[model samples]
Target: MSVRALVVDPSAPAAVRLGEVPDPVPAPGQVVVEVSHASLNYGDLNDARSGRVPVGAVLGSDAAGVVVRAAADGTGPAVGTRVVALASGAFAERVAIDTGAIAEVPEGLDLAKAVALPVAGVAALRSLRAAGSGPGRTVLITGASGGVGRFAVQLAARAGAHVIASVGSTARGEGLAELGADEVLVGLEGLERPVDVVIDSVGGSQLVAAWHLLAPGGSVQSVGWTSGEPAVFPPYATVGPAKSLTSFVIEGGAGPDLAVLAGLAAEGALTVEIGWQGAWDRFTEAAEALRGRRVSGKAVLEVSREERRAPALLPQG
Candidate 1:
């Protein structure tokens, strides 16, 4: 049987297109997830544009769904368990992912919301820990309306840091105070106050400004380069007493961290901001919105509705 999926035609110079591919069969230690929803990130936009992913790739990063088939080695979650996973070819009616990348969805949490956690949540969780964010530390999150930034804001606040959010526009900064940001500003202009930790997603000028805004003994965690510009901080920016600047990407093997984030969302400790949602066929619309920074939070896609009780065979395209 064939299932619907979105594939990136690397040479065609487009974002994504829907097509059919053979249904997945689990390998040992892999589970076949009947996808319900997926979360789109900024990196997804880059991959789509530059064709950074392999040619003819089914491009996607995170999904949440019910397991339709467990691994033959009996190592994955039960076939019926709902889970959030980070995997390749995730923009599909179904996805085959390793057991290690799948985290059982916490009770009473929507799969759509859980889908938003894996990529951004893992990055925020890891980066905050690396920045030594904790109670009494002042943490500044740039691009605070984006997925990783939103999570970092809440998680840092949960960790007892006085969270400050720097957004692209004053309008986008609206309501961030409710999301655990102690202060919100449009840019680095008026908020010259130094912070103990800077969770920077908007690199380039924002990154350079943030580097200069770091206090003595402060750390700047460079996560994403949304500005599409090179980061060039002055030498003196790094010469401060005990100041540090480091970059990171989400380490893929983070099932436990995904689970922790799901639990936090389920318990109301973390907010999963889904700024846009629609059927998977509208992927390009979502991608464009995200690429233009028109989306303040995650743009999620509803890949399939409910469980596919029986795999239906559709016309081979």
Candidate 2:
């Protein structure tokens, strides 16, 4: 049962390695999925370079796969169903996932494209929920050129709010606009207007600066600390205006929200950009590209070309 996988070896000082490993088995309340596609995130970059993830740990978190085996408890998905699962160690040919963490992807959706929907999509939904962005409100999204930011821009706009996006460079301005952002601000120049809600994914000094532009009673959802700096909140200033500051971490049991995202994608209301694609053997290269910021949208690992059609794994009797 050898399966191709990307293994991060801390002992190796140069780069991550991709090869073969034993296929994983499903435990009770879990299902074993044969991965079709997996997406790389910023966390994967940190894990690869610093070896923060244990040696031999697979690096991907979001993936679309087929349920190969169901849990004995009959509580998980059924075998042969095309589904999306959120779990660590997804940079492999197969992964065992708990029932609560998997979602049945809608029909007619591209399995590879669905790989990009889970993490970034959920983050965008939660951020907008926290901000209370809706009709008549103005929402601002920083880092709109990146994966999560792109989803945030679309989700906020779909909710009938005017979206103002901030990009790191002018090269991404047009893409951000195409993703439904009402306005694209390149390099943070001339953005003095106030917004009802601000989704800050870049964090650091930029997050601190964004706080000033939020309207009184507005909320800011801080999801990622990609800037590698501690967020300093001036308590007196934030408290005076009754502003709410919150952070989002996607743990487990986010399937319901993911289902909503899948529905949106099915309805063509949400668009997923496939920034780059590579084979499982090329995962290290993809990781490097993500680390170097050479990829736009989301980069996916095409584990296999085979497609499965059946109900997702369900708990065994």
Candidate achieving the largest TM-score: 1
* Tens-digit per-residue lDDT, 179-272, candidate 2: 8899999755798988899898889878987888888889888888777877686776566667777877876576788778887887788998
- Identify the candidate with maximal lDDT: 1
Q: How would you encode candidate 1's per-residue C-alpha lDDT over 170-279 as one tens digit per residue?
A: 88887789989999988878887789999999999899889888898898998988888887866655664888888787776778899899999999988888899988
- Give the Cα error of residue 4 in candidate 1, in Å: 1.6
Candidate 2 displacement at residue 161 in angstroms: 1.1
RMSD of 2: 3.2
TM-score of each: 0.93, 0.89
Worst 10 residues of 2 by lDDT: 306-315
Q: Go through the candidates in order and give the C-alpha RMSD of each one to the true structure.
A: 3.4, 3.2
Model 2: per-residue Cα lDDT at residue 108: 81
Model 1 ranges off by over 4 Å: 10-14, 305-317
How does candidate 1 score on lDDT? 0.85
For residue 75, what is the lDDT in candidate 1? Answer: 84
